[model samples]
Each structure stands twice: as structure tokens, then as C-alpha cells.
Target: MKEELSLVIAFDATSDAFAAEDVFRQNGLSGRLIPLPESISAGCGLAWRAESNLEKELTDALKSIDITSAHIYYLIL
Candidate 1:
């Protein structure tokens, strides 16, 4: 399979993660909520996986929703 570079954003709570998901979807940003990978941890059990290029878009979306403490990780998945 072709390797896709993804930005993994994790939060401290499911609500925060879901909130981010909603904003991104509503704004046409690209990403999806997924189970927290074994590779990273942020106290929350959920995370978001998005294309690398969408990092800024994700950030902006989070800003619109007032979500913070989201750790961003870039990796091939």
C-alpha cells in the first residue's frame, strides 16, 4: 500500500476529540477520529488522523472550537 503521511492529533478527553471532529467535518477539513494508537498517549482514549497537509487546517478548526492541549504527531500509517 502507498504510505500516507498523517497528522495524529490527540486530546485529553473524548469530548474534546469529538468536538474537533465536528468542526473539521463542518468546515470541510480532512480527518477522522480513531482509537488512540499505541505509539502516542495524551490521557484521552481517542485521537484524530489527518493528512499532513491538513495540519494547519486542523489547527484552525481547533481554534474555532477553542480546543487546546492537542498533541500533533506526523507519521506514515
Candidate 2:
């Protein structure tokens, strides 16, 4: 098996993380909650990981949910 790049969204707070999750769910987006990678920094230790190809969908969902406190990153996992 080999690693692949994924979309990682680090949240500034747990509320924001949950919000993102809800938004993704409501929008039929694909992703899961994961621990924030050590390579990234944020107020919350939780993050949403998704396929890199879903970047646009994820961002749009986040926007609809008014989650502006997330830091988006692309990391190999």
C-alpha cells in the first residue's frame, strides 16, 4: 500500500469542527473526522479528512455553513 494526498481541514474550535461535519453531511460530501495532524496547528485537535479531489465541494460546504475558522491543508496520509 502507498500513501496518498488528502484534504485536511483543521478547525479552530470543536464547534467549528462539528459544524463542518454537519455541513458535509447535509451536502452529501464524503469525509470523516480525524485527529489533527502534528504537521498542522489549530485550536481544535479534531480535523476533517477527505479526498483531495473533493476540495471544491468541501470548501463550498464549509462556506455554506459559515465555517471560516478552518485551515485547509493537503497532506499525505
Give the number of the best model, judged by TM-score: 2
lDDT of 2 at 23: 87
Using lDDT, give the best candidate's number. Answer: 2
Q: Candidate 2 versus the native: TM-score?
A: 0.89
User: What does candidate 2's lDDT look like per residue over 1-77, in tens digits?
Assistant: 78999999998888899988998999999889999988897343899999999988898888887887778899999
Give the runs in model 1 whose Cα sits over 4 Å from its true position: 42-44
TM agreement with the true structure for every prediction: 0.88, 0.89
lDDT of 1 at 60: 85
Model 1: per-residue lDDT, tens digit, 10-57?
Answer: 887789998988899999987788889887964439889988888878
Candidate 1 residue 51 C-alpha distance from true site, Å: 0.7
Q: Candidate 2 — which residues are off by over 4 angstroms?
A: 42-44
lDDT of candidate 2 at residue 20, scale 0 to 100: 88
